[model samples]
Target: MHYNLRHYRAEAERHSHADFHQIIISDVGKLELEVEGRAGEVCGRRMAFVEAGRSHAFRAEGLNRFLVLDVNIDLAHKTGIEALWQSRGRASAYLELQNGAQGSLLGLLDRRWFRSDASEFTGDGMPFTNAIGDPGLVDQIRLILGHSRQAVGTEKKTGSDIPTRLVRVMDWAETRLTEDIAISDMARIAAQSESTLFAAFQRYLGTSPMRWLTAKRLQMAWFLLQDCQIQLSIGDLANAVGFSDQSAFSRAFSRQFGRTPITVRRDARKLLGAKL
Candidate 1:
């Protein structure tokens, strides 16, 4: 993972990343982001997500501070954070973190990522190491993942049975991410009643079935966007991801990833070049 502290005074030219996922957390002042063709503003303590190869630009209203993290795509996948990554595509343009969690995260970045004497720092009893190798990077990734999951209301599984049942439901939903999935569908797949399924999801995932399905579809769309081999128009991609209208798909995409489909495609083209 790569980290940077940005203090912005002017607008940045439109740019894209080829192989890194970006997390931009607003710390001070106001910042406006233009991704694809859409624009959104970040104020206060909020974070924005930009998938690899997505085109985006930024401008500041005044002095703006940002904590940015750029994580390798493959390492992200290897961290058992597929669920977080899948649902991340559905995050709003800027997500507000709880005060305690926000402070803790910022403090961690300050003490560990920015400071040279980070060797003295310990997080949850794990010794801090220079962010130079995969081990240290992966540890930092887990820290971010843990905090992000908590920030997004992802709950830890309390019971083994709940996870087993939820896994069955998730597996069924994953295969049909592009289909219109209902609570009944999940219930049937899990061999449980609708209420039982709902309870299981609530206990293990802390969300409803349809909401999870929507997240799954968004994740599928994100996955498709990253595949240079798949030549698809935004409308086609929307339809492929079970969205009936392009506008709705665009809205959902922007809400999830803080970037537009056009932006994603543009960045993908730049990253893949001839392959795309």
Candidate 2:
């Protein structure tokens, strides 16, 4: 399984997920997890996991510095790396290793490749030697995983007034064009009903939720294309802006900007007089 680090800070409260398992480790501030039908608090040196398909929400009390992993389960299973998950379940306490150390461990356990050559082992074999490792630290992390699973959770809604809620929702929407955000989910984040959110958005932004989301996505796509270091193809650009298909991105770009992405990239270069 491959993973990317996604940082989040919820001024209010929100739920986040992709199509994979998520492991969140908090190193600063506090967050309350609202998972299933229960609620629990996690703070410094704490870790939590939200399994794929579970409905979980979190709120950062103030500032929150954390690391999140979206794991590829199928790949893990195919490669016999599921032992990491099993170890975690058997361990009953959360693990808090230094960032650099944890990064090393995660790279070894979660992927088919490792930065250090000695970390590789084939088949069901154990590749690591105990000489340079601490068995106690490993045991602690696994315990944390089990403890987190046992700690069920829910948090009270933010309960901001309608207008205030709508404003925050709009701000969040503008920032997350690449996310598979849903209207119902947005409504929940805003502490409003679907109808209330719809009416407020139309009144405030002069657009429906999806239309506004599409426009934001296009704007983000345009910005990314204008970045000189970005060498992604149209399909890459499309996926970056939340359109899973290149054709959809092309059509939407043409409709909104009156040109294809290639033309837009060209025009941006011409405007900036950038040599490529």
Candidate 3:
């Protein structure tokens, strides 16, 4: 398992994890989540679950505080909670853990497993060592797993081939963000016709292939600017991410994020300095 404390502004793309199941609990502010074809907002006492191999995306409103758990599928299976893993391919892609159980589980994860300052932790091959040794923690895990299984069973399953194809195309596109990717290329990668690919993107992601690619490239640039340890000029960064001109990249970045690239870098450095 991996634990993280996140403060996100917005994530404007539909993305997914290939393996680990994700459980996110909101501590402050609301999270807009879209999984499969369902959409919702999670806040207060609600928690969202995205099973392994499912397509999901979320963006925070403002100053969101949340805890994320990326639990390995193998660990769930080994713990005799294979139902959670099995539910991945089903149409019930998004599940919620609500009310008192949500609070209790968040408390357990926060107090026992997480550090506020640390963004992530890996189990180092030992999954839930403390939970396995303690009966109370074991019960808590069981309770959480039981709710997951119940949620999976309660939702009606729908059949859709477009999402699977879209996921395949997205996986291919993410790796080649800096390259000139065309709709035909995406279609070839997904084994669908260009028209079919366009329809899939429109129906599932609410955008065209090129528009989605642009958003992804911009998001990548935003992260690269915030990494102060990486020594790269703005022009180099722009060229590296497929933008041919620094001025064009700056304009695009400001339009998307409402802040200049220079401002973002400056603010990130200030934040880092404060942390130091």
Best by TM-score: 2
Estimate every model's Cα lDDT from 0 to 1: 0.60, 0.53, 0.62
Tens digits of per-residue lDDT, candidate 1, 81-166, equal 43464564354443444322333234335433566643321111232332534464454334344344222322323245556667
C-alpha lDDT of candidate 3 relative to the true structure:
0.62
TM-scores for all candidates: the values are: 0.44, 0.44, 0.43
Instruction: Candidate 2: count the clashes.
Output: 12
Cα deviation at 185, candidate 1, in Å, is: 54
Higher-lDDT candidate of 1 and 2: 1
**After superposition, which runs of candidate 2 have C-alpha atoms over 4 Å from their true positions?**
1-162, 270-276
Clashes of each: 2, 12, 0
Models sorted by TM-score, best on top: 2, 1, 3
Q: Which ten residues in a row have the lowest lDDT in candidate 2?
A: 99-108
Per-residue lDDT of 214-234 in model 3, one digit per residue for the tens? 777787677667766545588
Model 3 / residue 170 / CA error / Å: 0.5
lDDT, model 1: 0.60
Positional deviation of residue 232's Cα in model 1 after best superposition, in angstroms: 46
Q: Which sections of candidate 1 miss by over 4 Å?
A: 88-93, 116-130, 134-276
The model with the greater lDDT, 2 or 3, is: 3
